[model samples]
Target: MSVAVASASAPARKALWKNLGVQVVIAMILGTLVGLLFPSFAAQLKILGDIFLRLIKTAVAPLVFLCVVVGVVSAGDFKRIGKVGLVAMLYFEIVSSIALGFGLVAGNLLGIGQGMSATTAASGVKPPSAAGAPHSTLEFILNIFPDNFIGAFARGELLQVLVIALIFGAALLHLKESKRLPIERGLNAISDAFFEFIHLIMWVAPIGTFGAVAFAVGSSGTAVLLSLIYLVLSFYAVVIAFIVVVLGGICAMFRINLFSFLAFIKDEIFIVLGTASSESVLPRLLEKLPTYGCSKQSVGLVLPTGYAFNLDGTSIYMSMGILFLAHAYNVPLDFSQQLGILAIMLLTSKGAATVSGGSFVVFAATVAATGVLPLEGLAVLFGVYRFMSIAIATTNVIGNSIATIVTAKICGEFDESVLARTVREEMA
Candidate 1:
């Protein structure tokens, strides 16, 4: 009854034109055409994406806090919540490392950056600075905890906000049911409201995606994309392979059909493609995953934490980006040296989501940490970052969705019947 009721309540049918995914696809086609014909006008449309991002950001902190708090209270066992967290972190570390390895192997095999001459393009294109990134393990740990709770929300620091929510949820566990239940009820209502808020924000998704694609396509000609088109195209191929081979295998092991699971969340995939940011669908996942038979405890505990640590797609980008730079400059990395870089990437990729510019920023920090890769090479790659970002964001959203479902299954928080029901509804 839990998930069946929630999922069954969703409108099972709508006109194709009224569907958000259909609308987004149409907007993307229109936007691409506009970018090709009116580059000048498309450049100005970037504001539409910026505004959408701002509104989405405002909803994230509160939504995450509420979901985690309610999930914790609803589970009725602090020990179980603790177990879910541990399982999620373990899953994140293992899968992310695999993603990094895939990227490194693909770079070596494809030689995507070979014969590239970027010295002229690299100059004057400022590399993203790594100076502000945490220089040590202790510094990184310290940054996760907020000194000012409200300030964390204001600054959109997701890790800090997550820490606050976990502690707040644990504190609620200590309260008696009579007192705690009412608070939980109120939080749940607010969570529903935030879900509604996301639906409203989603209305502007096509507009935002249009502007984003328009800007990306319109401005790409001026960038170094043509010279490095091989890297861009190879990166996409590598990502696709990683998805089908690695993530597909994971789905198979867990008895979840990869195609069906992908179809179930195709809307989220397309939206991420349009906006080129997985954060755009964060709240929507929180609302939808539970209906897909994942418990609230698993969805709430795993998704946000996965955003921080389980960034499988970004993991791939960071390693491949690093290796590609070394190749572009003809900096020969021995087997041992490549392994060392992989080790550094494991740490750097975790920061991808927390950083403002996402994986590109963390990739910069990885380059700085290695000291072998030329930082200027980063600037040349920046020219094509947005092009690669669409695939990265799409992969990430799918990876985290799978992670949540896997976590739910392992923790005994999943319902097979609920999943079957949702699938029927989706197919219908």
Candidate 2:
């Protein structure tokens, strides 16, 4: 611990992009460049990319499960669970609706996917059997609670994991104090350990990002880039507009400023963009929430719930994408039918994965409900959709951050003084 020894260690500790988030970004840029230079090797790079993602995905179910359980059980309140749950569901519905509207407007204005013939490339791939489909609302509800909890984990079902976590957490709260303390402590320890493991694994993110982005760019080449570039740009534009206009208006109504708020979390945004998942920064956000004026209860309640529910970006992408497919096939739809799409989006948007390309399955449901063009039309856009995933993913992160802050302000949990201080730093 001598000053000389500390000084020597400092330089070693300062890695090339010492920040995991920064490393991830550099990896992405380098990966893309490599892909462009060595197109033939792109397929091998994809295997590398898939490995990293699979690692991340494997951890997701456990992470969410433990976090939710620890978050709720640690609150030590039975009634607040119901209260916070209601707030989360309401927030999800309202913001997701706005996102859907934005996508609807953007698709109409841009006229993407318009005037193209339906693709027949996927005609041979049979759809999954109806036995596996959630044919009714009741089936969807019942399927959420798995008969075997371990089976849910094995299957990697996010909604099922969430349900199990919430129920277990609630049951823990009802236990006697003597029994509850031991259980809560053990669960919290496990949650903390898993998060630590994530931090350790994050050291590899920069490398993973490089491989993933490079593989993507190289395999598809500029053809994929050019194909979806417009859609990507338009989607990003819509998200930015939503952040500035809709969320900004919300900030103004509360006498807060959006730019300043975003500035406070610039580092976090960089991390999300590179990693393409906001879940990576959930712990940091929770720590910073108090400084932003949220109460312990509000931060604990709002943030984790928001992850599952208030995915504004996903909602927008789902709506816009469906329309994009509709347009590409020259399928004419009346205004009433378009409105129905929005309604359906409202229901399906919540609980979608925060992972890149996770919305495709849910997108399949919306396509089915529309009863418009053939489902195979989606395959044509599949190649480019991967590139667009980052846009919606970024929007999802930004939307959740804003929602948590705004909700805190509404609940009188925000500290005006802290908000001013944070704003000053952001503006500077």
Candidate 3:
């Protein structure tokens, strides 16, 4: 009996080791240890993270374009697509503004970043240029339209690709079924192929995550975390509260269990934690959300748009960061001044979705644009940005996923029975 039990357990152990989530967790732990024990060597591992992100990015433009075109064509109604877009934008603005306000309130009440002198903060670090200058509202809007179609995909510009996909998809809607069927089928086949490609790339996630965490820890050193622990803790606290109160409420209103939803997407959540880039899991989300009963149209339209527009996590970071700097530098920001900061962040936060390093760049630009606080103050956050990014990226993914479901429900596109059945299967 003992020999038989051991033989059975061997297969169980092998299967556990084969699980991706288990491997990723192990990679994160080993990466942390390497970073702590061999800082110099670990820093050199940055290339691993860079390569993984580049691979994922290469697929993003084409995947997004194909998904959007297929979604739009399948829905078969331009007016309905327009309505969904309008509602999604409205939802994004309201929720994102609320997140900004929540962050500001949290920062003021907690008094994080206080008692640190601006000179002391700026002592060692050279200030980054206000390289990400705030574009005027008109300029920002105009920039969304790609000057050349191929350039958009070449540059991996999501908003530009979205525009091209929208036009292409709308044009497809006017074609006769005989003419459209073959093209739609072709696009769907290509989109499936891209998803398979994404799966192949994901096999490297453990190595990629290990390098990312190791480089972050190795370069910054753990000592910096002690000095900025309060800011980090406060930011995390705000994120949890937002999820429980804001997103939780939304889930309750939809009669879905927030905990169950979180459990269902736990794999993607872990991936975000490892990669620190929500875009890393875009293809997975596009495939999974439909299984949860959200219409493909809503998932394709709302989820991608939410990435660019919703950005609750980025908004929270921006508001809190500004206040943290203000308090640290002893710069007195009155109600009107803080409001001005909020106003500026509303626009700059949208720009955060444009690229890697975008959140920090936009934060720098917002501070410069408002002139409410000195730009040098941003240097203080350099040590903690990577740590903070993990939280922000994870939150953004959760928020976007929820947004897709909510939008689908509002549009009456969601199938409640299918959602219930999927959740049951997942739990089992």
The TM-score leader among the candidates is 1
Error of 2 at 183 (Å): 2.2
Model 3: runs farther than 4 Å from truth?
Answer: 1-14, 118-133
Model 1 lDDT per residue over 281-375, tens place: 99999989988999988899899988888888788888788778888889999999989988888777777766677788888888888888787
Put the candidates in TM-score order, highest first. 1, 3, 2
Write down the lDDT of every candidate, Cα atoms only.
Answer: 0.86, 0.70, 0.86
Q: What lDDT tens digits, residue by residue, belong to model 2 across residues 41-62?
A: 8547776656655666666678
Off by over 4 Å in 1: 1-13, 118-124
By summed lDDT, the worst window of 10 consecutive residues in model 3 runs over 118-127
Query: Candidate 3 at 275: error in angstroms?
Result: 1.1
Predict model 1's lDDT versus the native.
0.86
Model 1 residue 10 CA deviation in Å: 16
Superposed on all Cα atoms, the candidates' RMSDs to the truth, in angstroms, are 4.2, 4.6, 3.3
Give the Cα-based TM-score of candidate 3 against the true structure. Answer: 0.94
